[model samples]
Target: MTKQEKIDSFDPNGPASGNRIFGLPFSQKDAEIVILPVPWEVTVSYDAGTALGPEAILEASKQVDLYDPFVKDAWKMGIYMAKLDPKVIEKNRKYRDKAVAYLSAVEVGHEDETTDELLAKINKSCKKMVNWVQERTTELMNEGKRVILLGGDHSTPLGYLEALAKEHEFGILQIDAHADLRNAYEGFTYSHASIMFNALKIDNVKKLVQVGIRDYCEEEVEVIEASEGRVKTYFDRDLKHQQYAGATWKQQVDDIISQLPQKVYVSFDIDGLDPKLCPHTGTPVAGGFESEEVMYLFERLSESGKTIIGMDLNEVAPGPHDEWDANVGARLLYRMANLFGKNAGVVG
Candidate 1:
């Protein structure tokens, strides 16, 4: 059926019937937005389930209600996820075991030749994944599709950033609990913890504005200090302190957006949210924003007149029995996707 015909027959309030995202009926060609699901997670330092995130989120997305009060008729902004790459999946499963063994060895100071070999192999594959993402996204961009990357882990977006840097000089608005700035963290160049550090190497990326950073090491702080205003940090503690001093979130959000350039890329890690909302994420922190608070940030961002060049939502891991994490991820993705439409003047 054509997109209009599908729209005519579908019920927004009924049980989800198809495998399509949010039960929307548009195919990739019919939709204005495309979601690239990266299904590889090799260097997760704490948890192992995030490699399964794209499929989990895809399953959960079917159950989400399509109505949005903020972005009316946003369901018409079609979301089509590309087929998950099997090569990436195979490599993830193969390397994750080695990553686990290597991490365990590091914890006990038992690094050996085997661990070194594993590190080299994993790093090489991660580099390949990055290049794959850049190439695929470059093709999608060439087709005039607005792409949002749904990730295997935080490490998935380096190539997406590389693709964007070729044509646009944009700032990053990173929402996460960790600083993600450790250089070659744990000897893995593409470790999830090192995404932002590696991102800074891209000269076209002019600024990075980070928020909700409650957990980070001194080396990350040193990186920020050495960045010479290229990095702007809004620590979770300082934001709370300001709130306690009677500053409203609206005021704080304005301050945060002020640091960004005209063009922005949103990099959202589900762990940036309170752990209760995303308990199965790779690394859960003690304090973070509620879902609505983060949504409000996105909402305000849409109203700020800044162009959203691209976005990625990462680190959503599904539990064995509980669907709460993916459920939340699905709803968040729905909201975030609509805002993408709103920013681009294509929907809402």
Candidate 2:
């Protein structure tokens, strides 16, 4: 069926059908927004299952209702995820084993050529994954589709940012629990902890506005300070203090939004939400916004009329037995994608 034919016959209230994302029957060629799932987590440094995030979110996304209150009948906009690349997954598992072994040796104060070899392999493979993501992202962008990345870790979006930087000068609105500002964290060039540090290196990325940052080291703090206002942080503690002092959430969110430029990229790490909401995430932080609070923030962002250049959601590691994390990730992904669509004028 043609796009319109499928939409005309589809029932928003029915169960998801046809195996497509959110059960929408749209192919890559037909979609206005394309989701690229990156199944790589070689530099997690802590928990490991974030490599499973994309597929887990895909499975749990079947539970998301088609209707988004923020954008009426938004499912018609043709949202789709390309098939997860098997080669990427295979490489991730291979390098992740090396990372684990290397980190274990480092923990014991054992440094050897073998450990160095493992570290070298992991870093090279990680760079390959980033390049892989960048190539695909550029291809999709050339097709006139808005790309939304579903990531294995915060590090995964660096490639997406690279692709965008070539053509657009934009600021980042980063919703993350940590600053991710470590330079070559843990000696891994593309560590998840070093994502923002890598991102700022891109000349087209003019600024970074970070929110929900409740976790960071002195190194990251120093990075932010050295940025000389290029990097703005709204710590979770400070936001809480503002509320304790009788300021409204709207007022705080407005200030956060003000830090951004007219064109923006949204990078949401699941741990940015309360740990209870993303307990299985790679590195769960203690404090975060309620689901509704963040959702409301996204709503206000769309209202602000900043052109959403791209988006990414990452760090949603699902537990072995509990689907709660993926379930939450799926719904949030849906809402966030809709917000992007609404701003891009692809969804009403």
Candidate 3:
């Protein structure tokens, strides 16, 4: 069947088939939005399992209903996720074991030649992963397809950001629990904790606006302060205080949206949401936004006339015997895809 026939015949409320993202029937060539899955999470400091996030989300996405009230007939816009590379997954396991040992040694103040060698190897592997992602994303962009990066960790988007920088000058809207500003965190250059710091090095990233940040180190604070308006952070505590002082969420959202450039790239770490929504994420911090709150903000962003050039959803680890985290991630992914498609004029 042609793409239109598949869309017209597919039941929005029916069971999702195996083998495709959100159980959609479209292939890569016909899909308006293409998602690249990066299943590598070697530098995560807190938890393990995020390397499995892409598969988990793919499984959970099958349960998602295609009908979206926010964007009418959102499923009409073809969305397809590329297959995850098994080689990357194997690489993640290899380096993750090394990273675990290296972090263990560091925790006990055991800094020795063996640890240094392991760290160097892990860093080199991470650089290769970045390059792999960059090449894939660049290829997709060259095809004139809007991309959404499905990630293994917060660090997964670094290469996607690099690929985007080559084509567009845009600001980043980071929704996360931490500042992710550590330089060479735990001796790993591409540590998940240093994504924003690495992102800042890109010449085309004009600004970075972070929200729902409740956990960060003094060093990260220094970087945010030092940026001199290049980086704008809305700490979770201050936002709560503002709400307590009678400021509406809509008002705060407006204020947050006002800081972004006309073109924006959304980097969403699942830990940015309340822990109840993502209990398995790597770093679970207290006091975060509700799912609807963040969705409302995204809706506002869409209505504000800002173009969502690209996006990524990251750090969504699944719990053993439970699919809650992936379920949330899948729904959020659908929402983000719909919003990006609508903004790009591909979906109505």
Candidate 4:
């Protein structure tokens, strides 16, 4: 059988043993790509089940067409998929259950030991998750591989972000429905709501430019205001108003890009797209970037000579029957791989 047929025979859940679209052994070095599946969704405030996102994306990736119109020969870059760590899965479940209970309660800051204990458990587990990811990312970087992290949620990239920080000072191009600037949401230090806030804490993060922000609290606004120019937000409200008044999205994209630094790390939460593509994502805001616009944004970034050091496409969930989000995510990942390949001079 051919390589594709061999991979088709390896899927444990499917009819065969190695039916993965990308094939088995999951290790590809020539492509200069390391795909880390972080099966974490514990700190997700609104919805559950993102813990199942990475595997679903992987399964759906089998159906992804290798030909990318924008970046030719992107598939030649070896795409390496790392197996999901079982300990992270166990930790994610424990924290997910704890978060559900914590969020369901009336009094949030109840000075009780149970709350404290749960908080401790979640934080400790998250630290372990972050540290392991950091170590893995650093190892990959040292091996001269570009990394694309598949997330359990937005927060899954924190460790990888730290790893990137050590090597280069880069800016963040965050695409999400929410600002994710909350210091700590519902007493969860590593909450999805605080991903950007944590990034802001990193000294190496030059600037954080967030787009598609439509959900946030008064507290989050205050924090953004305090951040000054360090965090530049392109609010959906304002962007829509601009579009309503005849300003094109391209103009808006230009405005957003003006605030970024030279080197960029794209943090693309699938929720940043219209809800139709990802109805089951952790949080679904009313307004978001259309997939086309996001693609254009990446294209523009690439054309502008800004090196995309690393990126994460997270919070993509598979629906009951549809594989739309992963379908989109797989394409995004391929596009990003091409972009990284070009930046690293791997793809000519």
For each candidate in the order shown, give its overall lDDT on alpha carbons: 0.91, 0.92, 0.93, 0.80
Q: Pick the candidate with the highest lDDT.
A: 3
Clashing pairs for predicted structure model 2, backbone only: none
lDDT of 4 by residue, 1-348 (tens): 544553454342333125443543335454368888899988887777677888887787766666667766555555777778898888888778877776666265555777778778878878888898899889888888888998888889999999999989999999999988888787778888899999888999989998988988898889789887888888888888999999998888887877778899999998888898788898887878778889888877877777889989899877777877777777677677677776666764
Please identify model 3 stretches exceeding 4 Å from their true place: none
Please give the lDDT score for candidate 2: 0.92
Model 2 lDDT-worst window of ten: 16-25
| Candidate 1 CA-lDDT value | 0.91
- Per-residue accuracy of model 3 over 134-241 as CA lDDT, tens digit each: 999999999989999998988888888999998889999999999999998989999999999999999899999999999999999999999999999999999999
Model 4 residue 310 lDDT score: 94
How many Å off is the CA of 304 in candidate 3? 1.1
Per-residue CA lDDT of model 1 for 33-123, tens digit only, reads: 8899998789988877888888998899888888899998888767787888898899888888888888888899988888788789888
TM-scores of the models, in the given order?
A: 0.97, 0.98, 0.98, 0.90
Root-mean-square deviation per candidate:
1.2, 0.9, 1.0, 4.0
lDDT of 4 at 173: 96
Ten residues in sequence with the least summed lDDT for candidate 4: 12-21
How well does candidate 3 match the true structure in TM-score terms?
0.98
For residue 228, give model 4's deviation from the true position in Å: 2.2
